[model samples]
Target: MLTPSKVLDLYFLEARCMLIEVAATLDRFDRAVDSDTNGDGGDDRIEKLYESLQVLSSKSETPDRSEQLLKLFSGPA
Candidate 1:
């Protein structure tokens, strides 16, 4: 059985991880956009970026336990 503090800790860890994942996803999309604008190999990098952006958007909008986590973390910030 997990204690309340342990569960809270896990929630925070998960939220931070999710934020990191979102940042990395955005970075990847940015790189793909730059490559598509510059790549001459007809690699359709822009298409890949659009796909990634869609996924990232969905992830950002997904509702999970993170909303509560953020509220708890933002103690009067």
Candidate 2:
């Protein structure tokens, strides 16, 4: 059976992997935005996503649970 710490470790690894995947996906969207020139409001949305990803990628000295929860629930900004 997995200990609590082990479970938490697994979850942490999973979260990191998920963040990497999201960053990759954002990169793809960024490339698409660069190529497309229709300018049909997609740029705004992509910009927001990129900003959020940047926040996620930031290395904080301490884990801000409240801020993370707020961002998770509030959905951008």
Candidate 3:
């Protein structure tokens, strides 16, 4: 029932905050990687984060990104 503008008006600030938090986390991670001595910067979890970010940015017709992200972060059953 919500129009596109209405949806943005309701959720834009929250969504923007989340995005900023994610970016900040990534920046902190990059700093850690730069300061790490052993050079083992990333693991499977980091890879999953990167993949989830990709999913968020994908230009698919269907609005299934949240589903894709949920599955991406899920553990083995």
Candidate 2 ranges beyond 4 A from true positions: 1-8, 40-43, 54-77
Better of 1 and 3 by TM-score: 3
The worst-scoring run of ten residues by lDDT in candidate 3 lies at 40-49
Per-residue alpha-carbon lDDT of candidate 1 for residues 5-76, written as tens digits (9 for 90 to 100): 998877978967976886797687777666886554445644554554455456554555445444534548
The candidate that wins on lDDT is 3
lDDT (tens digit, per residue) of candidate 2 on 1-77: 88989988879889889878987988787787778888543646666566666666688788684486457557555
TM-score of predicted model 3?
Answer: 0.87
1-74: candidate 3 lDDT, tens digit per residue: 99999999999999999999999998988999999999978778878888999999989899999988998898
Instruction: Give the better candidate number (2 or 3) by TM-score.
Output: 3
**Ranking of all candidate structures by their TM-score, best first:** 3, 2, 1
Clashing pairs in 1: none
Top model number, TM-score: 3
Candidate 3 contains a number of clashing pairs equal to 0
Higher TM-score: candidate 1 or 2?
A: 2
Q: What overall lDDT, based on C-alpha atoms, would model 2 receive against the true structure?
A: 0.71
TM per candidate comes to 0.40, 0.50, 0.87
Q: Candidate 1, overall lDDT?
A: 0.61
